[model samples]
Target: MKVEFFFDVGSPASYLAWTQLPKICAAKGAELVFRPMLLGAIFQATGNASPAAVPVKGRHSGIDLGRFAKRYGVPLVMNPHFPVNTLQLMRAVTGVQMHQPERFEHLLKTLFDALWIDALNLNEPALIGRTLIRAGFSIDEILALANSPDVKAQLRSTTDEALERGVFGAPTCFVGDQMFFGQDRLDFVEEALA
Candidate 1:
């Protein structure tokens, strides 16, 4: 079985879900297919803004995120700067996934840590290269891959496909024909595997 994970590096909830999903997939003997999609387009297509844009949801989301983090023992730092632009990070992720999927997972985890925990700005190429290098990839390779026209095109194509598929949010998981949304719904994913 395959679980197609639709995610973006910019989303805190997507970060949380991505961190936990590997273990879940492993236990279920399911293949986790990471599908990097542009969350911005997803939001725009659905005529929806981020949770932070909603007054009530934004306020409660923090508390909920903290609780979810604690429940899973995943660190959640709630960056003071709500939404950080992650276009570069997303492109870099596409590059990694194209060349080194295994390394991509580690790079992704570190990127998430930088985004949600350390609250580091990923817009700087130096920071992104450092993060990738620290995860055991050559900075030059990452830079080269990010500059590849193929990777750039793939990101755009994937984003467009995701929007057309009616995906309007980050952290959505598809198990065969069933669609499950949110990190909180991992239980449903587990049950589906059962």
Candidate 2:
């Protein structure tokens, strides 16, 4: 089985999913495919509003996410800058996947940690550049690739494809034709994999 993970860095739940899915895939001997798509686009396409848009749900979600993080034994600090424009970050994901495939994993980890673990304001170009450099990526090269028309098109197509696949949210995992939404659904994911 191959697990297709559609995720965006801006979603805390996506980060929570990221913490566990890899290990599950590895243990199950399934190939893990990372699909980078913009959550904002998905929301627009599906007419889905963020869970955080509702104040009560947002507070409950924070506690729920923290519980999951504790269960997963991963660091989880909600970004103080709640709604980061991760356009460049998401673009960088596709760019690395396209150009520097070897660096994709490093890039993903760095960006995820910066936003969720370190809680950095990553939408700022300066911090993004510094973060990439520290992650052993060339700022100029990466930014160049990220800003390219091809990369932009790739992200757009991916987001469109996600919407077509009935994906209305991030951290969606597909086991063959079966779709599981949210990190909370990992048990079902594992069952389908089995």
lDDT of 1 at 99: 83
Displacement of the residue 120 alpha carbon in candidate 2, Å? 0.7
Return model 1's CA RMSD, one decimal. 1.7
lDDT of 1 by residue, 1-194 (tens): 88889999888889889878999999999999999977887887789778899889998998898999999898888887668676667878999899888788788878888889897777677877777777787877777777799998998898887777667888889887788888889999888887
List candidate 1 segments past 4 Å from native. Answer: none
Q: How close is candidate 1 to the true structure, as a TM-score?
A: 0.91
Please give, for residues 1-194, the per-residue lDDT of candidate 2 as tens digits.
Answer: 89999999999988999889889999999999999999998888788977788989988989999999999999999888887888889998999999989988888899899999999998788998888888888888888988999999999999999999999998899999899999999999888888
Per-candidate clash tally: 0, 0
Worst 10 residues of 1 by lDDT: 80-89
Clashing residue pairs in candidate 1 are: none
